[model samples]
Each structure stands twice: as C-alpha cells, then as structure tokens.
Target: MPAYSDAPLPVGLDALVGMGMNRVKLAIAVALAEHGGCLSTPELIAALGEGVAGTTIARNLNELEDHGYVTGDVPRDERRRRRTHWTLNHANLHADLRALIQATTPSGEPPTVTG
Candidate 1:
C-alpha cells in the first residue's frame, strides 16, 4: 500500500475522551489508519516505536478488537508460524466518531472551529 496521513483521527481524540479512550489506544488507531488501514502486531510496534514493548501493543490491539475498533486474523507464515494482520473496521470507527460529533453538536451538526 501507499503512505497515508493520520490527521483525521487526532481530531477525534478529544471527542473520544467522552467514551474513555486514551492516547495510547488512539495512537494505535492513528498508526493503523496511516498504514493503509491495516498492520500486524510487529508492524504496529515498529510504527509506534521500538521503545514500546510488543506485548503492550498486543494487549492494546486485543482490547481494540474486543471494543469493536479493529479486527484481524492470525495466519500462518511460510514456516507454519502464526502472525497477525490487523485491519481497521473503518465503518464502525467512522460511525462511532460521527455519533460522537453529532452528540456534542447542536441539531446534530458537526462543530466548526475558526482556527
């Protein structure tokens, strides 16, 4: 895939606060959005940073999956070892964010800022 920007999601971070999402979880989301809307555990770790432990990413990913934000599969590699390939559930994500925006806005209009 090609390189993509992650700007749209950072804008939703503040909105997600009402729903109890933290920056780390949102970071993982943004990274996945940037990476062609899909990335495995190792890919997410690399995109996040080497300093971030793999287990942490895995744990967060599992949580995201459970929360209906992301979904993926553990496919076996050529060596018969399993590896994860995560794909963003964009439909779910967009709908959730849209609901957030509509909830916070008047008449369900998205809030506009002059800055």
Candidate 2:
C-alpha cells in the first residue's frame, strides 16, 4: 500500500492534471470515484475490463498516489502477503482541477473551452 497527501478535489479534475488527463488515468479515476473510493489494482483491472495488465494498473495507481488523488492502506486480511487497498482523496482531486483550470484561464473570462 502507498500513501498520499490529505486533500479534497473532484475526481475528474484530479485525473485531468494528475495524469495529464490521459485516457487510462481518467479511466482509473472514474473507477475509484464510481466505486466510492477504494479499489485494489486487480479490482481496477477488472473494472477496466480485460487486456489491462497488472503492471499497467500498478503504474496508474502509483501515478494517482503521487499526485495526491489516492491513498493506500494495509489490507484487512492478514493472510494476504502484499498489503493492497486504496482510497480516493476527493479533496485533492477537486482542488487540483480547480487550480489547473484557474491557472490556465484568464481572469474574469468565461472558460472558452467549456461553453
């Protein structure tokens, strides 16, 4: 399990800048958000459907954690050798996205890209 910063943000915004808003990272974020925060690598792969390798899932999880969008905890099962569990940091996700958009847009101007 990995650790992440304690923060609040939306999943979409986090995925956007956290992983450069790439498709795979966005998918991972959606999976966690849809599941209400908390999913193992295998679970994410399963949710993403087949063809997603373990390494790919691992990479995405790590990336999310690095960006403070997700946090990991020890597995409840003691029998499980590898401690693996993750929770979404909604605060960070929302904050990051807001910051990203604000930083990119001019002051007092409507977001041209959105409308």
Candidate 3:
C-alpha cells in the first residue's frame, strides 16, 4: 500500500485549486474515481471523448500524478519501450472534493428550512 499524508484534506484541495485545473482535469478525476483508480491513457481519452489529444491527456495525468492524486508505473516489453498505467488515489480524491465543497459554502451558518 502507498503511504498517504494524513494532513487535512482541505490542504490538498486547496493545492489543486491553486494549480488551476479546468474541465479536462475534472473529467480525468471523475473517470479515475469511477473506475476505482486505474486506467490507461488511451482508455481515459476514449472515455472522455475524441477532442482530447494524447499529449494533453498525458500532461493532465502528469499533473494529477504530481499532486499525489494518482499513481503510475511504466512497464517495458522485449524492446524496452515503456507503457504507463495509472491508478487513482481515491482516498485523496474524495477527501479533496469534500473539502473543496465545504470550503465554498458560507461558514458558521446552518441550513434553514423554509416550508
């Protein structure tokens, strides 16, 4: 098992927000979450739609990986060329989303019913 930072999830969420992710990143995150944390680049692109380029996908994946949101490894065949496989870190994923949503709402206020 991989080691995870136990610091408040909000920190990580804030980090992601600071990184300036757009719809592409969100889609990648959702796809990784839905798959229970593992998918190929080609698979992700196919799942997301045709307009996404391989280089763009690679870049986003690298960003997510750098942020500790995903993990990947390269496997080589007889020619020694490498292929990478990515796995989402759900622990981080859900925690980050929860924290982000919580941060967006007004603080010190409870929801009131208006029936």
**Candidates, ranked, TM-score:** 2, 1, 3
User: Which lDDT values do the candidates have, in the order given?
Assistant: 0.70, 0.72, 0.69
lDDT of 2 by residue, 27-54 (tens): 8888998997888766878889886777
User: In model 1, what are the clashing residue pairs, if there are any?
Assistant: none
Error of 2 at 65 (Å): 0.9
Q: What lDDT tens digits, residue by residue, belong to model 1 across residues 1-115? A: 9995544543444434433476667888899999999987778888999767777777777777766788777632331345788888777777677766655678755565321
Q: Per-residue CA lDDT of candidate 3, range 1-115, in tens?
A: 9995656544446556523467778888788778776777778888888888877877887777777777776632321344577788767766666666666668886533221
Give the clash total for candidate 1. Answer: 0
Instruction: Give the distance in Å from residue 35's predicted Cα in candidate 1 to where it truly belongs.
Output: 1.1
Cα deviation of 106, candidate 1, in Å: 3.1
In candidate 2 the C-alpha lDDT for residue 59 amounts to 78
| Model 3 residue 11 lDDT score | 49
Which residues of candidate 1, in runs, are more than 4 Å off? 1-19, 75-81, 107-115
For candidate 3, the lDDT comes to 0.69
